[model samples]
Target: MFAAIIAAGVCSCYYDSEEGLYPSISSTCDTTNVTYSGKVVPIFANNCLSCHSNARAASSGGSVALENFADVSAQAASISAAINQTGPLSPMPKNGSKLKACLITTFDIWVRNGKPNN
Candidate 1:
């Protein structure tokens, strides 16, 4: 009985991987190679498209369409401010949670990179 109890406790007491317990450590944000098509569009697609797509911009995105590169580049300043929740304007993803730190970094980097078509 003592041996069984010891074995059970030992088996159950293993440490969880860092990635599982604290994602930030292992899930470092990839900031080295952010690109407009490779990184920016996908973020918008996942987080902003429901309201910010071209088709719904007038009614849902407050006329802020992000479905294409030109539109996003035109709105770059506003996008940066909104995503960081820094300006007097309401934060973007409107009522949603702030984007992940990595995602924000990625967008900011892309903007700094001139919102390139690449």
Candidate 2:
């Protein structure tokens, strides 16, 4: 899936394997203590805002605003479901792999940890 996302040109490479790279996204929290403020916001800011936020007038799912922690936290259940979408439906940001596996892992952890504010 990661390969396909990259191949489809949905996300750009922030660092190369040859560069002994840094993670594509940055967050204050790690896998052990994921939280909305520290871990999840950065992912959405970099990946999802192109379409999901007010900055873009062409995006869907406008019923919810994803600009900040408070807005996102209010939509916690929706965030969880999107992150874990199945079948034909893709997760948030529609199609983008800029977010590394570690980032997604942190999101999973945040959901598992009850979507804390941090």
Candidate 3:
């Protein structure tokens, strides 16, 4: 019975934080080229577009469209807070693992750089 219980516990899926999975990601992350078109967009494309895209926002992403420069720039402050899982904003990638530290840092830098459209 103990063996069976242990097996079940070990096999069950649990939420994995980035720190638990890839501690090295923070040190190696390249935060120097965080452009709206290049770095920021790709992050949203991978992690957010399914819900936050213009076409799907109404149905799934609370109408928060991040597919364009104006919308994203407008929401940049909240985006930073949400990704860091802090402030009044809800932690993002909602119901999923936290974003890697590097990605969070990159996004924060973009937001701090005046959220430029470039």
Q: What is the C-alpha lDDT of each candidate?
A: 0.83, 0.62, 0.82
Q: Per-residue lDDT tens digits of candidate 1, residues 3-118?
A: 99998876565445323322452246666678888899999999999999989999998988999999999989989899989898779889999998778778877887788898
Candidate 3 ranges beyond 4 A from true positions: 1-25
TM-score of each: 0.75, 0.54, 0.75
Clashing pairs in 1: none
Answer with 1 or 2, whichever has the higher TM-score: 1
Model 1 misses residue 3 by how many Å?
60
Q: For model 3, how does the per-residue alpha-carbon lDDT over 38-77 read when each residue is reduced to its tens digit?
A: 8999989999989999999999999899899898888888
Give me candidate 1's TM-score against the actual structure. Answer: 0.75
Error of 1 at 102 (Å): 0.5
Model 1, 55: alpha-carbon shift in Å? 0.7
Candidate 1, after superposition: displacement of residue 31 in Å? 1.2
User: What would the per-residue lDDT of candidate 2 be over residues 16-112, giving only the tens digit for each residue?
Assistant: 3312233443454256556677668888877777676755624564545687677677776776567656434457556644346577667766765
Clashes of each: 0, 0, 0
Candidate 1 lowest-lDDT run of ten: 17-26
